[model samples]
Target: MKNLKVNPSNSLKTSRLVIRIFASLITLFYLIAFVPKLIQMLLGDAPERPPGADWEGSMVTVSFLIFILGYIVTWWRGLVGGIIIAIGSILMFLTHMMSASGEFEFLPFFVFSGPMLLCGILYLVFWWKKP
Candidate 1:
């Protein structure tokens, strides 16, 4: 019987493509949904806050901007982008908790950041495994 050979590199390449596509899609979605609003916020056009929400809002905005920067950077530098995305994800959660105060909502935070976190980890893994 002839021996059938399996190429590990092909599988690795496939995984890399999969992760890249997922990351790209996530980035695209966020960019489309928020980029315009983010621009407005950054340009000092954001709607007025109630009273003491400025700090919390700024924290949340900065965290999201960090995540977006990571998304843009991932195309060029996977490892660095991954680190940034991970940091941003945690910051998003923490800032959210700070704003919530008494009633903490875990589901919303996880739902928003979980996919980004997963992609960041995958990016780091692929970068480390690269030959």
Candidate 2:
């Protein structure tokens, strides 16, 4: 009889750790970003929205939900979480692109979406190589 031992590679371990940490941070960042608005709403001082801003606001809300879900799932399944985050990031990027008036408008989209895409890719890489 032969016995075999399976162990996770260091890269896999490191990647998993990184994914967990990054996912947590990403979730926290999104939640923190909403704190002001939440506070205002709770205090009955929510600012009035400009005309024709509802669609953009709704899109942002949906994307935020997707990111939250993706981060939550990352704790269990890295691949699924990565895909979800990637999808959310892509949707957000497209939304911003569609509404952009010029090159300057893409700055904010890139700033936010770039890290998200990177994190998503990192998670996928780790998931693919998981032992």
Candidate 3:
């Protein structure tokens, strides 16, 4: 077997590619997750709204829009997009954590937060060193 040398630029490109893909995936996941709820609400199939439901729903809608915008920017403006995604991911992770009780389940938190955080960090690192 022959030893292979890795080029730093090539590695960086690879990392950026991975980050872009991850961002896209996260955006897709959010779309998939939210569209059903959105349709349900529109169709009046959602459960009865509690107090402050409108405010909560509005916030969620805004956040999802922001996430989509961040994802689109990630392909062009890495650092800014990364910060947006990272902040969103952190908020989501914290929300899941706060909602869990003694019988906590890790899957929900991990599913929502893991890829966003990982790719966001990678994008930040790569973009930070670009210039």
Candidate 4:
């Protein structure tokens, strides 16, 4: 009989690569969208809003920052970073949902949180399967 065996470490490496690429792509997309606003704010050229400004936008930004932090950390530690990414994605979704008059919207989630949440889940799954 022919013998065949699967090496778990190779699968783990492949999964890790996939998770890293997915997270990197997401981080790149986010940075492309966010860096301009960040630069504008840093340059003190952001448009001034009226008093009692939009707290929702600020909250979204905070959540987005947390997501970015998870992306950075994922390179170092997949398990903890995945947890952070999940939390960030949940916060991002809820914040945007609140800003949309407390209505659940699929479009916003697809655009912002869905891919990130998927990536985070993938990370955790692969981590758990690691040999």
For model 1, the run of ten residues with the poorest summed lDDT: 44-53
What's the lDDT of the predicted structure labeled candidate 3?
Answer: 0.71
lDDT of 1 by residue, 70-110 (tens): 87898899899999988888887777677747566887586
Select the stronger candidate by TM-score from 2 and 4: 4
Best by lDDT: 4
Clashes of 3: 0
**Each candidate: RMSD:** 3.4, 5.0, 3.6, 2.9
Q: Which residues of candidate 1, in runs, are more than 4 Å off?
A: 1-3, 36-53
Model 1: number of clashes?
Answer: 0
- How do the residues 1-131 of candidate 2 rate in per-residue lDDT, one tens digit apiece? 78865456865787688778876787788788766776776787877653235776677777778877877887888899889989988877877877646443767576667667777888888888876
TM-score of 2: 0.80
TM-score of each: 0.77, 0.80, 0.74, 0.85
TM-score for candidate 3: 0.74
Query: Which of 3 and 4 is ahead in TM-score?
Result: 4
Error of 1 at 87 (Å): 0.8
